[model samples]
Target: MESLVIPVLILLIVGAAVLLVARAVGRRTAGATGAAAKTSRGTPSGDPVETAKAAAAKLTEDQHRRLYALIAQGQAMAAIKLYYEASGEGLRASRDAVGALAAHPQPFRSAAPKVPEHDDDDAPERFPYRYRAIASKGDVTREVSSNMLNDEIYGRIRTLARSGDTEAAATALTRHSDISMKQAREFIALLDD
Candidate 1:
């Protein structure tokens, strides 16, 4: 009976220690998650516009949209590079800012600078210009050449590519061209870069 009592006490002590450890670990994890959530949501971080300005002071309205688009497409590295170049910030700061921006998107403060007044709304400039985009992987090569696609339009398409919405991007590409979905997919596949 005495031996039983000692063994039982030891078991209780071990169980109590385990419970204490688990509770401590849980509290630590919970605190960390809270901080992460706060960071991602931009609540504890303060006003989003200020954050955007501080992180990317030189980002024009169009650049801002394209950057966010890249983030949406899950092109973290490209987004970071774009931010870094646009903001003139170091790589690390750009990375952290990009991470936060991707987690919580911020709208463009003002209207996207009006598309230059065009005689035709669908077409920009006085005359529609033909632009060519080529993507090559292994031995397979794809080219998308269309007068309907300008830098701004292609930027939109590339943004869709970065955000991992190749289908939407492909659809947009086809809409801009006479190509079939298969050709659009082939072209969009090269656009991932």
Candidate 2:
């Protein structure tokens, strides 16, 4: 029993120390944004993602959408490179700036484990039905996938709206709405005409 107490106390102290350090660091950094990473608000200077976002604000709608889409793919660095390639920014600077933002990603919190309650059947009942907490990992994955797809679809739509002919934009929108490629050619024709 005495040995158990020492080990448990040591674990608690270590855990508390770690939490305090993480919180301190987190407080200094930007809150939960993939962009805005570089230096924390308390630290020295501005980061690349912020700079890119600023530059992006000046871009036409098509470029803007593509930039964000690539960002969603964990390719913030690639997005920066593409922009620099297409625009005047040099490759190294853009890549470095974007890559800095990508590294040291925001830590993710895993769902908490649920503890089940045991009810005595013979004893006096406090309530009615058994409230079982349910969580499906598949559901979480599906939801994330759906969100990603939606972001891509919107990004593509923005691109089409900004550059493609009216018929093409309409076709793209229609195709995206269906989640299939059916009638895409006809819609493309509409844009052409």
- Best TM-score among the predictions, by candidate number: 1
lDDT of 1 by residue, 12-79 (tens): 99999999999999999998887764433243444444565555445678888889889878888899
Q: Give me the displacement of residue 89 in model 1, in angstroms.
A: 60
lDDT of 1 at 171: 84
lDDT of each: 0.75, 0.48
The alpha-carbon deviation from the true structure for residue 24 of candidate 1, after best TM-score superposition, in angstroms, is: 81
Relative to the true structure, candidate 1 reaches a TM of 0.35
The global Cα lDDT (0 to 1) of model 2 is: 0.48
Q: Which pairs of residues have clashing backbones in candidate 1?
A: 72-163, 73-162, 73-163, 73-164
Candidate 2, RMSD to the unseen true structure: 27.0
Against the hidden true structure, what lDDT does model 1 obtain? 0.75
Candidate 2 lDDT tens digits, 1-193: 9979999999999999999999988876646443543332222125554554445434455665665568779776668877676556556545653454344232223345895663222322223323221113322311111211244444554456456554555454443343234444333333332
Give residue 58's lDDT in candidate 1 (0 to 100).
54
Which regions in candidate 1 have their CA more than 4 angstroms from the true location? Answer: 1-127
